[model samples]
Target: MNHIILGNSLTDWLIALAVAVAVAAGLDAVKAILLRRIRSLTAQRASRARGVAVAALSSTRLVVLAILGLYAGASLLALPERGQLFAGRAAMAALLVQCAIWGDHGVKSWLASPRAQQAEDPGRATSSAAIGFLVRVLLWAVVALMILDNLGVNITTLVASLGIGGIAVALAVQSILGDLFASLSIVLDKPFVIGDFIIVDNALGTVEHIGLKTTRVRSLGGEQIVFSNAALLKSRIHNLRRMEARRVVFKLAVNHDTPEPVLRALPGLVEAIVSEQPQVRFDRAHFNGMTAPAFSYEVVYFVESADYRVFMDVQQEIYLRIVSMLAEQGVRLALPAQTIHLEGRPAVLPVPLPQDERVAA
Candidate 1:
C-alpha cells in the first residue's frame, strides 16, 4: 500500500476508516439488541410511545450509520475547503432524506396502530387514509425544503413563492377541493355510508362509493348516479337505512250514503287490520270529515323495520283486508262524481235549421 496518499499516510487513513466502520457497526448492533429486547418485553402491551420509537428507529438505522461513518472517514483526510463544505452539505442532505424516510414510516405505523384503529369512528377508514397521505406529503415537503436550505438556497423567498402559488392553485380548483373536503366530512360525520339507501332531491338510490370528489350511487333503475360530494352535502339527504321505524299515512274514502255507524266503526276496523299485521304498530285512525263525494278517513301507522319491501307488503295486506272487510259488511267504496244543479231553464230557445235548408229556409 502507498505510505502517503492525499497528504495523509495510508496507514493512518486505514485506521481512521476502520475506527469509523467499527463505531457504526457497534452503534447499529447496540440499537438492534435494545430494540429487540424492548419489543419482546412490550409485545403484549404495545403503547403509543413504543410504536413511535420503533417506527422512527427502524427505517433510518443504516442510512444514519452510513452518514456518520462517511463524515468521520472524510475528516481523516486533508481535503480543500470547498470539498469539505460539499461533503458537509451532502451529509446534511442525507440526514434530511433519512428524516423524511423516518417520518413517512412513523406516520404509516401510527395510522395503522391499534390505537388509531380503535379511536376511529365507524366507517372512517377512508378518512384516516387520506389524512395519513396528506401528513406524509407535508412531511416530505418540509424535508425537501430543509435539504435545499442546507445546499445554500434562500428558502424564505422560496417558501413565500410556494405559499402564493398554492393559494392560486387552490382557487383554481376550488370546486374540486370543496368536494374533496365534503367527502372527508361524509366519512367522518357519517351521514351515510356504503350500502345505505338514500334519497337526495328527486333521486333515490343506494350509496356505493364515496370518493374524493364525488359519491357514486346505484339508483333504483339500476344505473349509477354520480353526484359531487359538495352538492350532495348541500342537499337534504334521507338515509332510510338508519331508520328504525317508518311512518305511514294513508287515506281511505267511503261512499257518502254509507251508514254513520259504519263510518264511526271505520277507525276501529282499520286499527284492527293494522295491529294484526306482523311488525306493524297502529298509530291512529280518524274520520277526516266529508269531501264532496265521499266520507274521508285518515289512517296512520308505523312499520317496525327500515325495509321498503316490508313496508310495501304490510301496506298491501292492510289494503286487501280493508277492502274484504268492507265488502263483507256491505259497505261501498266511493268513486269520484260531479253533481250539477240548475235553478231555472232558459226562457227562449232558437233551434237551428238543418244544413241542407240553407239561409232562406
Candidate 2:
C-alpha cells in the first residue's frame, strides 16, 4: 500500500510509532537504573547532592517521557513548516516543565536532608522553610519565562510590565512587605530564635514562633504577645538566653559607731561568703561611704549561669550565710535613728529603745 497520508506513507507512520514507543520505554528503563544507583549512593554516603539527584530523577514522569518521544518521532516525518515549528516548541516547553519539576524536587530534598537537620546552628535548619519556598518560586518563574520565550513571545516587554506592576503593588502593601523583609532578615541574621528568652523593651517572653508577618512570644505572665515583624526589628531586644553569667550587686549598712577593725574585716568576710557559694565568682566588696544613718557597703558577684532560678538560689544562700556571720561577729545592722534636744531639757531620742525612757541623757 503506497498510499500517502499527511505526506507520509502508511508504512512510514507505523515505523515512526514504533520508534516513539521504543524510545519512551528505553528512557524509562534508563531512568529506573539511574534512580536505583543514585539511591544506593545516597544511602551509603548520606550526601545531600546525591539525595537531591535521586529525588529529581524519581520525579521524571512517564507522560513527559512519552511527549519527548513523540517530539523525536515528529522529526522523522515530512511535516509542514508550521507543524515542525509547533512540534519543536512543544518539545521545548515540555523539557522546561520537566526541568522545573526536577528543580522543585531537588530543593525540597535538600531542605529535608539529614545534613540540614543536623546543622550546628538550628536557625539555619528552621530557616530552610522560607528558603525552600523562595527557591521554588524563582525556579518556576524562570521556567515559565523560558517556555514563553520558546513560544516566540516578546518576554522582554512582558517582564518590564510585570516590574512596573510589582512596584505599584509593593507600594500599596508597603507595611506588609516591610514585615516580610524583616522576617527574612530575622531568620538570616538570627538575633534570636524559638525558645530564646527575650525582653523587647518592657515585654519579656520566650519566642514561640517566627512568621512572615509577626512573631509570637509567650510572656512570663502566661499571656501570648504578638509583635509585627517590622516593629519588632525596630525595638531593642535583650536576648537573656545567650547570657553566659549574671551579675549581682547588693548593698548593706552597718552602725556608724562599729569598730574600725570589724569594719575592715567585713569586706574579707563578705568575700569569703560569696566565694563559698556554688557557681559564684566574687567580684568586690567595699565600705564605699558613710551616710547619715549608716556606713554603707556594696558587694558584687557573678553567678556562672544564665538561669534565673539558679541565680536566686545562690543569692539566697549567700544572704543567709552573711546574716549568720554578722550575728557571730556581733555586728549590728544600722537602723534609721535621730536625737533631738528640747531647750533646757534632756535630748529627746527618736531611736527605739526596749523597756527604756523615751528621753536620752
Candidate 3:
C-alpha cells in the first residue's frame, strides 16, 4: 500500500478518519442517553425549566458534534494554511448558528411555560410571540456580525451603519413603536383585561380586544371605539370592573309644609326602603339639612355587586318604594318656588314719572 495519499501518510489519514468516526459515534450515543433521561424527567414531573434546558441542548447536539468531529479531523490532516483557516471559520460559524438555534428553542419553551400562561393577561400570547421574534432577530443579527468579522470583514463600519439605519427606522415609526410598547405594558401590568368595563375620559365601554397598536372597546352606544394603545394609556382610566362594591349617595327633598312627624320619619322610611332591596347594604339616612324650598334628606348605601345594571335596578326599586311610601303618608315632593313681596307702595309707585307721561298721552 502507498505510504502517502493526498500529501498525508496513509497511517495518519486512517487515524484521523477513525478519530472523526469515533467522535461522531460517541456524540450520537450521548445524545440518545440525554434524550432518554429528559423524557423520563418530563414524565415524572413536567416543568418549564427542564423543558427549556432539554430543548436547547437537544437542538444543537447533531450540529455541534459534527463541527467538533470536522475540527478534529482537520487538525490531524496536513492541510494548507488557507484551508485550515477556512475550516476554522466554518466551524465557528456553525457553532454560532447552533447557539442561535438553542436560544430560539429556549425562548419558545419559556413562552409556553405554565407560569407565563397563567400570569399573563388575556392576549399576552401575542406579546410573547412578538418578544420571541425580536429575540431571535437580535440573536441572529449578532451571530451574523460575528461571522462577518471572523471572515475579515470591516464589522465596525457595518455596525455603525446598522446603528444609524436603526435610528432612522425608529424615528420614522416612533408612533407605532410607542403603541407597541404600551401594549406590552398593558400585558405586563394588567391595568385592565378583556371583558372589563372601563371609562377613558368621557368614553365608556367594555374592553373587547387588545391589539398591538390599538385597543377595541364596545361602547354603550353599540359601536366599537378604537384607541391607540399609547394614547389610551395617557388618558385617565376608570376600571369599574375592579370595584368590589358600588357606593350610592342620593338626596330626597320634600315640601317644607310636610308635618314634623313625617319629616322625622323620612330617614326611617328611606332606611327601610333601601333594606328591602336585594344586594343593598344601608349605611345611613338623615335629615341632612333644609334647602331654600324644601327639607332635604340624604341616603347612603352600597350595592354588593360591581355590576352597573344591578346597581341601577336596585336603585330604581328603592326610589319607587320611597315614592310610594311618601305618597301613602300624604307627603309631596318639593318643586322650586320663590316668594315676592310688594313692599312700600309697589317699590316706587310703579315709577311716578310714568304717571306724568300717561297724563300727557
* Clashes per model (N, Cα, C within 3 A): 0, 0, 0
Q: For model 3, which pairs clash?
A: none
lDDT per residue as tens, model 3, 185-299: 8877878877789999999999988778999999999999999999999999999989999999999989988999989888998898899888888999989889788899989
- Measured against the true structure, the TM-scores of the candidates, in listed sequence, are 0.78, 0.87, 0.75
lDDT per model, in order? 0.85, 0.90, 0.85
Candidate 2 accuracy as TM-score: 0.87
lDDT for model 3, please: 0.85
Q: Which one wins on lDDT? A: 2
For model 2, what is the C-alpha lDDT against the true structure? 0.90
Alpha-carbon RMSD, candidate 1: 5.4
